[model samples]
Target: MALTNPAFSTNPAFKENGQAQTAATLSAENLQQMYEAPSATSVQTDRMTVEDTIVKTAICFAFLLAGAVVGWIVPALALPAALVGFVLALVNIFKKKPSAPLILAYSAVQGVFVGGISFVFEAQWQSIVIQAVIGTLAVVGVTLALFASGKIRASKKATKIFLIAMFGYLAYSLVNVILMWTGVTGGTFGLSSDVRIFGIPLGVVIGIVVVLLGAYSLVLDFDAIKQGVANRAPRIYGWSGAFGIMVTVIWLYLEILRLLAIARD
Candidate 1:
């Protein structure tokens, strides 16, 4: 499911007249020369670019990894980290402007949740964390390559389907959590485990579908980034793109981890 970050589209920099208008009297030759000028680096102009977005994403991941290491060493912090991360995520998502500190903070806290939960799952599954990590990376790598190659693109119809599926998944997840908490379901995965289709756990199917949804979400992220860069959005918005990507990747990893665990069981 795609977590829409308003910072990408709601910002004024992307709107008409947000940027300075070019001089109308400028000659065609002058305009051509200006267009041919060296591409603006992040430091050169406050405009967005693919490179800046990459750096922002790398920074977020670095903070995430650092926090993950701390969380892995102290597994008891998982739930608390998750709660805090959730609140921070909401704040970042709803904030009018993208704040680097808040985005980084969210990444760090989410890392703690990821690491602690991974450790807990690894303790029982023996190497499942590594598997999930590799799986997540593989999926991301392939999706990126496909997108960069222009072999895949997001379409309005597909996005509509994706949103519908995401809503259905959210509903299912809510009910499953309720069942688990109320002691109505007798398995670790609640309805996902209790229900079977063709002798396979329902989670396996749901997990695969969720993973596909996550993949499409990545495509949307890429599309958003492309639009941002093309529109010469403010560099600060790159952090918003990075934040969206990190959230999607984390969701992808968790879903893959759960799917693997269910399969192993």
Candidate 2:
């Protein structure tokens, strides 16, 4: 139930041959024309399709799956793979121009990281890995359904709340890690075990909330893709879309894994 990698904007008509564009070069009249939408601003991207996202995501996942197999066979690559993936993730994020090869390679490295981690966790919890996988699929499926039915959407208010929640969660995670590292807590799972609300672990609650956030992220991704199409953005933004989906899926899987671990514990 992973989200498909998003496709690039299909607006080849407005492209500047993969080169960057700016107002300093375009004439006043050209700029004026560029500002105007080809049709009504309110027009929806009904014509655009989500199929490409699926295809591209499948490709990324294929590479990931392949990397996982390799990871299981060669445990030594796990640490290096994770480090490489982290660096690649940063590089991809800061790069103004999307490089397809580099992005795909990043996916491969991430595959090894994910596979190795999953292997370790699954070994510890036995069937819990399966449970987490099912949970991830269920969450992703339900979110997509809600979105397709127009029951869920990304609004400014929700986005604002999401940002605040993410920041708070990050801060809490940092504090929790510090607590664990400083030997202030004797819990096995850090804040996940030490902090419980009404007998329920904090991590479980946080996981559910974060799952919703990831789903909303999908909505935002959709909105961005639609806007890109309308804006006649360059084709490479497809890589951007793919990268975005990868990020969301990774986050979702990690959250699911944590939730399952807490449940098993």
Candidate 3:
């Protein structure tokens, strides 16, 4: 079988053998129990399943929340946390196979950066963090529901548009960052604050666009998980799906927080 999915392609469990395994022989009664098994599970067989993915995602989230609490208490760690998290994100993306330790580490480090930045934003604008959290959850819930209902899907055309928009947004961000570093704009948000279109802060516009991209990213993640399950991917591959979802959700939350801050400004 052709292993196209990156997660499964690197896994050895999916490899097939022409010769049958010579394990301990089973009798007819043992075979009968096999047919009578209650249900298939990740532990029972190395195949992927929705329940396994959910469990993996929950574990990652637990580590993330724990790390967030630590970072919340020490807001000064935000900068370093962001730097480390970026490096880890790149590492995880390029890895041939999923590593539970690495994925969990990424989640914890990212959570630190998220918590620290959230604390900073909350200090500047009261109640902004709560609002952003709610907005993030709402977007994720709606996107998941739409996907589950078959109202939304990943298509080549929409994916092309998403890539184009992502590139444009990246270019704008690079320019904005350079301008700010050189002290060209003195405002808190640099170009986003100084530039206005239709009496709205440019950041608000960009933030809205990025938020939409993040939501679509979640949809893509869901699609990937669905495909993996259908393809009978290795159970461990669920971590990849969980990691992708966490990254997109974090991006969405940050964008929502920025948009709310700009609006309140």
Candidate 4:
């Protein structure tokens, strides 16, 4: 017969001698009313929610766009921005708790890198930026639609595969960079551009696979957000969701841009 409602259990009115007062004296009607009362909402409880996460994500993107403008105007800052952003990304990923300022800062720096790279690519291939943007949007839109429709879902097995693929891609990228720096390969994209398979550039084939991996990574991000909401996580954690989405989307866009550039070559 003790007060069972969490909202009232801690109230002094419901406590007697530092212990919860038994509701034995209360009428059955009162107990029924209390039981039937509406529960607290996510906002009232300060919990994570889909709408809040979306708003946070949008804010991060706004910062990104603003930084991108500066990067476009001064392409020289691209390399430095990329290095700083990478460090920030690692910090954010490894930190136990989410920090809004750090996450937003990472977004801004990443935007600079994105803008600088886009400018470089555009200078070489006219309209390629638009093409990459369209391609990225298409992939994101389709992936989101599939997720919302329950056609795509994250599974342990698939995530394991994704991690393996990501590691492989990273290793290959590192080797390619080394080769480029050492002048082992002449093309802009190193092996990706220099090698060919059945008259098709190796980059085109690898790019297609990487694009699919990026899409699946998006799926994982969506699933994580959904889980966070379901678990009623703290509201501040929404920034983590925003950060994850931004990282995935930016990676996806850059991959698409590179793919288009290689294909055009």
State which candidate has the highest TM-score: 1
TM-score of 4: 0.85
TM-score of each: 0.90, 0.78, 0.90, 0.85
**In model 2, what lDDT does residue 33 have?**
94
User: Which of candidates 3 and 4 reaches a greater TM-score?
Assistant: 3
lDDT of 4 by residue, 183-249 (tens): 9999989999999999899999999999999999889888877876765567777888899889999
Backbone clashes in model 2: 3
* Alpha-carbon lDDT, every model: 0.91, 0.74, 0.86, 0.86
The local lDDT score (0 to 100) that residue 240 gets in candidate 4 is 82
Candidate 1: Cα lDDT at 100: 98
TM-score of 2: 0.78
Task: Please give, for residues 29-59, the per-residue lDDT of candidate 1 as tens digits.
Answer: 9999988999757878888888889999999
Candidate 3 lDDT, 101-219, residue by residue in tens: 99999999988988899899999999999999999999999999999999988887788898899999999989989999999988788888778999999998888889989988888
Poorest lDDT segment (10 consecutive residues) of candidate 3: 1-10
Can you give the lDDT of residue 210 in candidate 4? 97
Count of backbone clashes for each model?
A: 0, 3, 0, 0
Question: In model 2, which residue pairs have backbone atoms overlapping below 3 Å?
Answer: 5-57, 7-238, 8-238
